[model samples]
Target: MPLDVESLRSHFPSLASGIAHFDGPGGTQTPRVVGQAIADTLTGPLSIRGSSVASERNADQAVLSFRSAMADFLNADPSGIVYGRSATQLTYDFAKHLSTGWGPDDEVVVTRLDHDCNVRPWVQAAERRG
Candidate 1:
């Protein structure tokens, strides 16, 4: 089924500006409710994530719940699910890590159709390896 973009837009205040955003690979405006939730959490009884105390346990649960939610959404193990600042950062990090296995003759084909954030990382990583 197609998603209701209009319905989704109601939660994102940035959409009110009538600007179309396609730069989500690097950064994107978060929904207003998400921003509100974050503010609420920060202002609430938050503490370092651990099993030592009530606040700590709350923090730990938040982290674990986020991981679990992401895992369920992706249909992957929670242990395998990871979050980064942006797709650009994750792609760059992975490219750098994967480049160690590439030989001088190895070629990576990143289409021009891809966002620059996706293309530059691999190219830079491969160049660094070479």
Candidate 2:
């Protein structure tokens, strides 16, 4: 089936405001349902993930549900689903982990078109490995 671009775009309320957001650390525009879910979770009765208390159970369920949904979307195992505070942090962490197996013979190439956050992590990782 053909993609419904307009229908997908309609879900993001920020797109209607006619402002382009470019801040990498800020975050991308989220859909209305996603925004609502985030707001609800932030304002909801939440505690440490557990089953002893209602708040804890709710928080635990929310995390499990998110992991399940993301796993389904990515066609990956839910056990492997990882969440990071930011893309930059995740990239750095992943680069560090991946570069452990690199040798002096290996080459790490980054393009100028990429953002600094994307480029710096791999460069630093390669330098560390070398």
Candidate 3:
């Protein structure tokens, strides 16, 4: 089924204000569930347990849950999905790893249309590796 816009809007607390959200290209507002999940991860009972087997299990479950949700949303292989602070950072990190397979004569093509966050990191990585 197609996503119900009204229902999806209801899930996001920030949308209640009817604010103009033109900043989506940079970052979109997160839903209430995302905020609560983060709180639970940081402050819930599972986080308080000191190296207990149950705590480890809970942490593992949390990671698996996050991965599954991301895979579902992106229609991607969960193993191929990497979590990072931003797409720019992730691409830079990937470039560093990939650069190891390249040599001094190899060239990396980057475009000016990209955001500085995306461009600068890869440029820095290429320079450092070279």
Considering every candidate listed, which one attains the maximal lDDT? 2
Better of 1 and 3 by lDDT: 1
Deviation from native of the Cα of residue 102 in model 3, angstroms: 3.1
By TM-score rank, best first, the candidates go 1, 2, 3
Candidate closest to the true structure, highest TM-score: 1
> Which of candidates 1 and 3 reaches a greater TM-score?
1
**Considering lDDT, where higher is better, how would the candidates rank from best to worst?**
2, 1, 3
Reference-based TM-score of each model: 0.77, 0.74, 0.61
128, model 2: CA deviation in Å? 2.4
Candidate 3 local Cα displacement, residue 71, angstroms: 2.7
The TM-score between candidate 3 and the true structure equals 0.61
**Each candidate structure's count of clashing pairs:** 0, 0, 0
- State the number of backbone clashes in model 2: 0
Per-residue lDDT of candidate 3, residues 8-124 (tens digit): 788777778888574333346678887887888867546432346776667666767777889999998888766656777787788788778777787777787766666777787
Instruction: Please report the TM-score between candidate 1 and the true structure.
Output: 0.77
- Determine the C-alpha RMSD for candidate 1 after optimal superposition of all C-alphas: 3.0
**Residue 6 in model 2: shift from native, Å?**
5.3
lDDT of 3: 0.72
Cα displacement (angstroms), candidate 2, residue 117, comes to 3.8
Clashing pairs in 2: none
